[model samples]
Target chain A: MHIGRIDESATLGDSWLHQVSPISKLLAFALVLAAVVLSWNVLVIASITLVLTAVAVSARLKGRLAFSLSAYPALFALIFAFSAATSVLGGAVIVLKAVTAALGAVIVILTTPYPYVFAPLQRVVPGIVGDALLMTYRSLFLLIEKFGNLLTAARLRAGLHAGHPVRSARATTRALGGLLLYSFDLSQRSYDIMRMRGYEGRLRVTLPRSAAPLIDAALVGGALLLAATSLLWRVGWRDLNPYSWIVLAVAALGLAAAAASTWPARGRTS
Target chain B: MSHIHIPDGVLPFWLWAAGWAIALVMVGVAGRVAGRSEARRKVPLVGVVAALMIVSMSSEIVPIAYHVNLSVIGGILLGPALAVIAAFIVEAVLAMLGHGGVTVLGLNTMVIGAEMVLGWALFHAILKVIKPTRAGIGAGIATFLTLAVTTTLVVGIVWIGGGGEAAERETGALDPSTLRFENPFEEGLFEFGLFGDGHGDEDEDAEGERYLSVGRFALVVYTLGPVGWLLEALVTAGIIGYVARVRPRMVFEGALAEEMARIPGDETGGH
Candidate 1:
């Protein structure tokens, strides 16, 4: 799922996006989501997708990983579009809407650590629920690692027979059952440890301070402008044909700048 | 299979919003039910199970193009109260990972939560008539029934969101009594000369419009869904059977504990 890679990028990357506050990134994401939801114009949706793609590139996000992740939603959107029997343009709009929204989320997730993103949400959610969210996020890495090991062991043992569906399902289920038991035990041990450590039904998390307010403000402001343009186009108050081209051109320039920044230095051979 | 794969901005605003509203209320009720001192011990279990669900959902059975939700298994182990919470956690995480629309998180939770609750109920109901050793059979039946019901629910939601106009035009606003499927393909079955009639009309008007109506969508879903359901059911049965045999307490706790105590030399009796 590239979750491991995403986590590494979010925690290790030192890009401008990684420096912005999680709240700002989330706000920008919400703005993009609103833009997608409010507008059905193919050109407008395409513009949003292009802009986000450029943003992801400029933020030093992995382009291939982002596209691969966004492809899932695109596939589902294709099914919905086909079922709706929409015109080619209408179908493109649906696909673009899905891709745009997905790309926006990828950008946010690829830049922000999950805990930092969830810290603000702790205020709105119940203490227990918030704690559970943190616990789940923490447990994911452990379980994913164990799962990978189990699959590898099974493959080595010839326990997974892909040609025989029933046999493979049986083996998979057996592995899963064992994993569930292990997880149940892990949860019990974890609860005991938490109790011993003075867990009072809540986990404390410190929100990262915003160190780049101007950049954060610029990100949110740009998102707001994009959303406003989409809403205007949706209400027929403005024709976005010219604006769409301008946005696309900006996206191209952004990509070029990102590429130039990432290009290797001329004299270094390391 | 029952989870809505509908991307963001497709379903009407009010529909998804209402889904969110109802789901929030349900989560609140579940929290209250599982908030007791005894139930408090299950809090960490909820997190673990939710993480397990996310992991399983990420892996697909490529042959069927399906992912085992494990919600039924989660329900069987965690009970309905904690399972609902787990369902919500799983859906929210998945949405953030871009597996589904963030807007449909609530709807996905409800769909999967219903599966868990229904599967649990059905498992116990079947247990009343069968031996504990056959828990696998009970779980399989429960999984199949739960999946069927939830799949129908998905189709109904899609129809409500304006994907079933052909059926609506003929039957009038979801009137199942008058609903019927029109052949999506206008050409006869043997038009290509595999069987009888080799000659077929090439006229576009005669071929008729081809679009996926609600009925047609249902047809496609039912055709493809049973294979996935059966596969999931078998896997669920196998897992439950293994767990029940090894550590029956994990599967038969709470109310079932007392029932298991009645059986002679049963290890699944007490906490």
Candidate 2:
């Protein structure tokens, strides 16, 4: 999703991926991200990227989510590569892993609405942190709107239409300062409104249906496989040690368990 | 003065995780220490401040690619504890956008939060001793110091990530104190560089040739950083002055307003 322009409708699709629970998606994303970071093998990363593409296809996402996932890392990687880098291939590996990590997160965010993502967090996380996240998530778009309006006004008044970098930055800062004050007032009022509705500190949370552990297990297992393939087979498995073998065994078992778990439970719709 | 731009997977997991864990604990502790009323204020302020940070950090300053952190201002406004929370949120959002990596969120938080804390502490401490009008000078210095520390930390982390010992040995052929400080008086404008005793080592570094050694990196950081550091400090001072004018309470964490309310005779004969 584009920064600041992420439409609510983006997460409102009825694909099976969208129907998946937020918690599961979050877990899957975490695992995949961990795996991507843990391994540095280019081929392994490539395979993970392919897997994510497959997931996107399955989810029926029409937009180019893959590009968004890879673009940030690719930009930086390109910077390093074109510079006096020791290894342009290392940059390639970084891009692949970055794409893998971003894809994992994108899949989760694209499918799950923001509210659903934070709603269950209250039950899981302590204190007002979850509620705070929910409120921030809900209000961010409106706050962004206000910020944009103020920024435009400030830019015009300051004659920032010209390519004056420092001047433009200065105007933006002042606009943000005013926006900061406005946001405080808005936040307090929102708090008051919530209080008037008999809210003490915490929002009443209705937990989404618990995701099948199997889906998360499968995602994590696939992530582990990605990690294993990248780290262990860099030059072929001819000189495999016992420790490596053990890791492979565990990863294989995890994959089996994940496959078993995703199997539809007695007439349960996917 | 300084901010991290290292993308994800560059830093080791344990290091970044530790950063996140420590930052979280600090935020929690900071909230408690701020007292109930101040804590209440922070709950809302954190979001706005985080939004400000995100907006600022998202863009670059052109050729140098350095983004104005504005975190020092955040630290000055939110204090140390809330700054951590706010910094964390900003890093998290940026992580999602891919400017920085998600895994390094905690580490990024700690670095930015430290800037906020250092700036806040330095500014307020100076405010106690100096006139209120000179608060911006204190902010400028605070901004300078914050960037200096952040630069050191960033360089140190990179060194560690690149296998510090090997890199050290590789650079040992050159003088250890290779960074020559450019005299701002003679230099038309400051530039970030390492004079490096005019030595080059072809010892095949692990981290890539484009990146410099810790010592050289420090040289580069200080060389280039100060130009922005000077500009940023001025901007920070300007922001501080403006905020103090419009809303003293916003700048001073309600201290002036609280004191005035407590005195109760400000409009009367007591003045």
CA RMSD of each candidate after superposition: 8.8, 11.0
Q: Candidate 2 at A219: error in angstroms?
A: 4.2
Top-DockQ structure, candidate number: 1
Residue B126 miss distance in model 1 (angstroms): 1.3
lDDT of 1 by residue, A1-270 (tens): 677898998899888999999999999999989888876555567778877877887776877888888877777677667656334555666678778888888888889998887787666655656677778887788788888888778878887877876666667888888787677666766666777898877788887878899999999998998898776654431223335556556656766776676566322523
Off by over 4 Å in 2: A1-4, A7-10, A62-66, A73-85, A115-128, A155-158, A163-170, A204-207, A210-221, A234-270, B1-3, B31-41, B164-224, B254-271
Query: Which one is best on lDDT?
Result: 1
Model 2 interface DockQ: 0.12
- For candidate 2, the per-residue lDDT at A17 reads 67
Residue-wise C-alpha lDDT for candidate 2, range A112-205, written one tens digit per residue: 7665655653454334444555566545676677877887787668746567887886786677667655655655555446656766655665
Clashes of 1: 0
Instruction: Output the TM-score of candidate 1.
Output: 0.85
